[model samples]
Target chain A: MNTLFVKAPAITLRFVLLLLISTVAMVADHRYRVLEMPRGWLLTVMQPIQFVADWPAQRWHGWTEVVAARSHLLQENKALLEINQQLATEHQQFAKLQAENRRLNELLQSIATSSLPTRYRLARIVQVSLDPHTLQVQINLGSQADVFLGQPVISSAGVFGQVVHLSRYSAQVLLITDSSHALPVIDQRSGQRAIARGDGPSGLLRLPFLAAHADIREGDLLLSSGLGKVFPAGYPVATVRSVSTPVGEKFAEVVAVPVADPGKVQEVLLLWPDRAVQTIEEPVTDDLVDDQADDGDHE
Target chain B: MNDVANWRDGWLILTTLLAALIIDSMVLPQFLGSFRPDVLAVIVIYWSLMAPQRVGVGVAWVAGLLVDVSSSGLIGLHAMVLSMQAYITLMLYQQIRMLPRFQQTLFVLILMVLGKLLAMAVLGMTGRLPTIEFWFSLPASVVFWPLIYALVQRWRKRALLPS
Candidate 1:
């Protein structure tokens, strides 16, 4: 059993060599495109593993479908139809507002009219990264359907995350609740601007620089300010959950729960909105274009 | 089974590792996310001890690489961590095997936590401070070691050997 290769020091040698290689790879990945090709291929190769991993969950989901009662499906259908009817009712008023806004833009001959018509596609969550530190999810849509890096992804209810990486058949979205993620948000109640950063997957956002006496309150809705030009403006990002100021602390430790539950989103909305939402083309613009000021997000 | 001289168990190990990878990446209910076992880590630990020559540092490195890729994480991140884990297991296999089952579990708890902390350190150095869920995974994985050990043993008896 005592092979020469199995000598005690051999294990140390292998471990050190492999660790050195891995560390170099990680640093290279973080700093440059040095490893993108290999990384992409590895993910592609591992696709089947992920697919097979998904099989049990997918099968379990199918089982639920098989046992679903006819009455239950019927009830679900009816409820969905009713919701559609309500949305359609809201659509009529939105089209009128859109026309009026167009007219106003024409009269003013402003850059707001330069905003391009936007389109969006639906994608399903295929995999969720199990790493507790990095909050990311893999969606079924990829470069095939015009998915791009930095494109904004939203749930039907509100803004969720941004697409970070894309393969041919899948993409990864970094959730706003990740610690490294920061977003520009405006409080709907007071129109106060603050930068909301994720504290981690407790599903809450922290406003780091807001003054202790800022006119913010619990239950205030925070919307994308669009200052970052990544997430479109006026989508609900989070709702204020708490506000606190420790003794002598300069900024209020304002806490908020994300309006879009990263875990609960079955399908994501990939938006193709223009860079500025209005793209005033002004270098120093602070306000998100007010052309869609009503901000109902009809589409 | 004991009398059999055959050592052709490659397929059995591969299937278990594949299953482990799948289970690790599968999406679970939100409440269960915290309790999600590090299936791949546990499996690597089990195999490096059960059959060190077959599934040593190199096998563990590949397993870690697969996890990093499949999870869509930074490349080589898990490869380094899992390789370290397997190395430690190899170093202590003899002593660990001699311990009682409960003590074996206790040792596993320490090893799992240490590996997790090392991975966490790598993330922190890369400027990503993971959520509490990441921190919670150590305990979660430690709790799953006995199950992994038993499963590997069962596979050994049921598939690897002929009765």
Candidate 2:
């Protein structure tokens, strides 16, 4: 036991050394963007362990999905078919409207061309944070593909989150449902606008600053007003679940549910629109010149 | 070296950790998730209490680091809190062993809460404090403590039985 005392200090020293090493790693990581290489290396080494860690849960989820009652599956299938039919009809109308909008845009382009460079790519969700407190998701795309920091992330439903950290082959998305995340949104129906913030795993969103008499109601859809320019206009954000106006409180307490179901989404599209069309005269391809020559010959 | 070949004991601990990680990640029943037990924490605490010579602050630190990496948070935060918890548990092992099962569980439950609170405090100071989910998970951990204690105890007893 007396000898154990001497070994104890040695163990503590070693432990402190490990702590110092990790702290230095973290600090260096934060201080310089150049540290990204080592961080990527660490993530690559850790990827296998992460896969092992997630295997059981993912397998169980797969099993449950398989064992679900046939009747329930049929019911879900029917519901999906109905929803698909409705969407198909809406999509046709949307296509026509889009064509008209494109024509109008072309006419406007004759006058001026706005040159805001934006681009996007599709990525898959590789993992989600287990701790409900931190609503974050990891995507498989990273700096290798030019995914910059602070890029807005969205889903089919609406704005999901923004890219906070980037690595070589992966990036961490800060979900809008995260406590630290907030977005500017406006009610699509009433045109009243307010800031929407996450209320944590209760899966609720709150619009904290609305006048007591604001014409908002349950089921009102909130959309991105594009005021911040981070989010594109008219993306569905949330639906008002409840509105509370307590006497003497200046702001009405508005609770909303996010349009995107964070748990189930597998893939997301990252949009990066072209800023300008740079004309580069490549040595004209033989095939292109031949086609043009053929056209001239026919004329 | 022969004792290290105790597959039954090693496998049980591995399975328990796997299950806990799964439950922590997945969308389980609302009540269960809300009061979800800290499986890894309980396992580390139990091992440190029962076999202080084998499991120590280092093992706890590694486990906590894994949890931190698995979750999206500051890297060292969980590792630091877990080492602190293991240290306290090791110091109090003798007194804990003497207590009744229920009393021991309660003592450990307090330790788990302390660990969680400490982690939250570290996160808060770092400006990474989580929202309401942080507060909700603490009480939920306490509520699930008894079942976790019983499950670990049963496994320990089963492993100790000479085959």
Candidate 3:
């Protein structure tokens, strides 16, 4: 007790020193962007802790699958086969349409839509962010798996998010529904482009910049405009939930719910859009390029 | 003999801190995200009061940094906030230790609320405002304090005493 009293001054000194260090670190991280390398290294060191935390849930899920009744598995398999057949037929039509579109673009002499094909890799959510202020999730894929910053991630249903941080074995994704996230979206029905900004904890998006008389309506589908180039064009992003044009207001109060639910997403796909076409001096043959695109789509 | 006791104390505290870090990073159901208690804060508060010599502001700051890295957040946010909490706990540990259990829990609730507000202030400075559910952890922390306090006490008793 007496020693505790004597150490009061020491505690003050330690607190001041630590606080100063923390301020410097925060400024460096948030403003300067110089601490990314060290942050990545630290994430690598902390991987084991996160892995242990994720293990129980993963094992329980696996255990439940193993013990699940045979009838249930059979039913699920049958339904999945039906869905697979439907997708295969749809994909065949899509391939033919894509070729026709490419021929039309060539005749019109327009820049080919994303000169290179996009590749996707599968990943699973290993951890959800602890901070309630941010909506981010950690995926099992990382730099070791060639995951890079700003790479787009999507679920089977729609656009999910983009990778923001990378470690050796894991990466953190900034979900589209995060408050700080804004995406360029176009209404599929009206072809009107608007910015969809996340509404934070409400898990909704707000189009605050659109004029009151803009051509948006409730139930309209929003797709990625590809204007940002971060996400590919034509991916479903959200569906407009409500549109309210307040009297005498410059902007309409529009809200939307994300098509992809972060809560139910067990797996996500990371996308890689090939962007290095300008430097090539030799002209690549079209059939060869189409073959490559087909291979990329197989993933 | 003093060296051996000090080493044991370090081992005990480090193990508990590691557990807190794991639980803090574990995935939970979406509805429980707002209600999840600040397990590291509670552990740091408990240890800084009971074993002030072993767990001080330095340890608290490092714990906070680990949290920031694991959460992939702005690096020093938690470090600064948790250091402030540990500092207050250190400065007032003697008085807090002497209070009744009910009063101690009340004091903890106040401390947690203040810590939450401080974090919000920092985030607000960065131009991102958290939702109202950010404060829900304060009540959850209050509910879990007695359990954490008793658990840490048992470990302290088992590990700190000379056999």
Candidate 4:
């Protein structure tokens, strides 16, 4: 008779009801995205708190950078500037080559028009998820910034991921290294395209579908093939790490390491595909009908 | 005086929960970002035990929802776990609060494990099974409970002191 056992079974009933509602909400949210509007509004409400939560750490980080050795910082800064200039020069050359490709394809009456640079917006990562399987980060830019679902996200180093969830004030970017993420990529050296998927704990992408005799080899660069129309074409995705084909196996096992430095990146650039000039990423296997017609006309 | 105590305890609960969420969501990411303590769940369990009348099922539900939203996970996922934690505390508050601090920590350890299991179930139902990193967090949450409990206890005592 020491304990006071007050009659408050109503809490249990409320718990059950809340549980049922939440479970149903999870199913509904996952299957139909029925709660997007509400979730977006909630995120807008929560953004300030997130900022406050992130403030101390971010400020501490800022102070450390400010207080760091000037000599070391200067050396790193100079090297980065040099790399930036080199990349800018190489990018100009790529643009010129693309222009020439468009002109030549136009003269040949081919439908292949070079894909231009995708529209982009910048977003700083506000918070990162602690779950290993769901390697996601919330960015400050969202629907208010015209950040939409399925838009590809990239850092200066390489492709980071794609936007999976969009809120009014912020959005979640699912990293390419997440187990569920896969992208169609082509080996730059061999021109062999394969699907690369994140290997859960390994942190490297697995190309499980390449044929036994696929031209993939060690150290080949893999670029996004842009097959899914989600990630833009001609961006560096990952570099081949190892290729293993068991003697009796029908398919070759390949793995690649992503180019982005996941540890240090704080901001991601979101690229939205231009709906007007959607370029296909297929191999040019169509017949040269215009050449035949031109030859006949000359004859 | 009783009402004032309850109100002070409620404010303490709110601040502690907010701080827990901040630590749980931020400051935990390493290179791959896993195996961090479930600070938010542990705080919910602690507060629900310490002040069940104040931090009831409704408060727990909202706290869980906050974690869900902060992590940008599927909404309502943490809400379910939180409500269960609060409900259990409300039902057994009289018995549990009377136990020693060490026993209470053990109880919290079990609750955190169950919370982890429930989270795994929800995740499995929704998507992929969490890696070993997520499983490793259960014990880490146990290790964290004492420190969090001490800090929270001091905060609560200070808040309840005569002004």
> Which residue ranges in model 4 land beyond 4 Å of their true spot?
A1-6, A91-95, A276-299, B29-36, B146-151
> How are the candidates ranked when ordered by DockQ, highest leading?
3, 1, 4, 2
lDDT of 2 by residue, A113-232 (tens): 322335657888874345455677877787788665556778878778876556666777777776556778888888898988777656778888788999899999998776654555
iRMSD for each candidate structure, in the order shown = 1.9, 4.3, 1.9, 3.2
* Model 2: how far residue A114 lies from native, Å: 10
Q: Please give the lDDT score at residue A111 for candidate 3.
A: 78
Q: Please give, for every candidate in the order listed, the TM-score of chain B alone compared with the true chain B.
A: 0.89, 0.80, 0.93, 0.87
Docking class of 1: medium
Tell me the deviation in Å of residue A250 in model 4.
2.2
| CA RMSD of all predictions | 6.5, 11.5, 6.9, 8.5
What is candidate 3's DockQ? 0.66
User: What are the models' TM-scores?
Assistant: 0.80, 0.65, 0.87, 0.86
- Per-prediction count of colliding residue pairs? 1, 9, 0, 0
Q: Write the per-residue lDDT of candidate 1 for residues B1-163, one digit (tens) a residue.
A: 4224224467767888888887888877778877777888888888778777778889989889878866768778889888988899899888888999899888878878888788878787766756676666667787788877786677667764456
Model 2 TM-score on chain A: 0.67
- Candidates, ranked, TM-score: 3, 4, 1, 2
Task: Provide the lDDT at B35 for model 4.
Answer: 60
What is the docking quality class of candidate 2?
incorrect
Tens digit of per-residue lDDT, candidate 1, span A56-89: 7778878999899999999999999999999999
Quote model 2's TM-score for chain B.
0.80
- Can you give the lDDT of residue A11 in candidate 1? 81
Q: Model 4's chain B TM-score?
A: 0.87
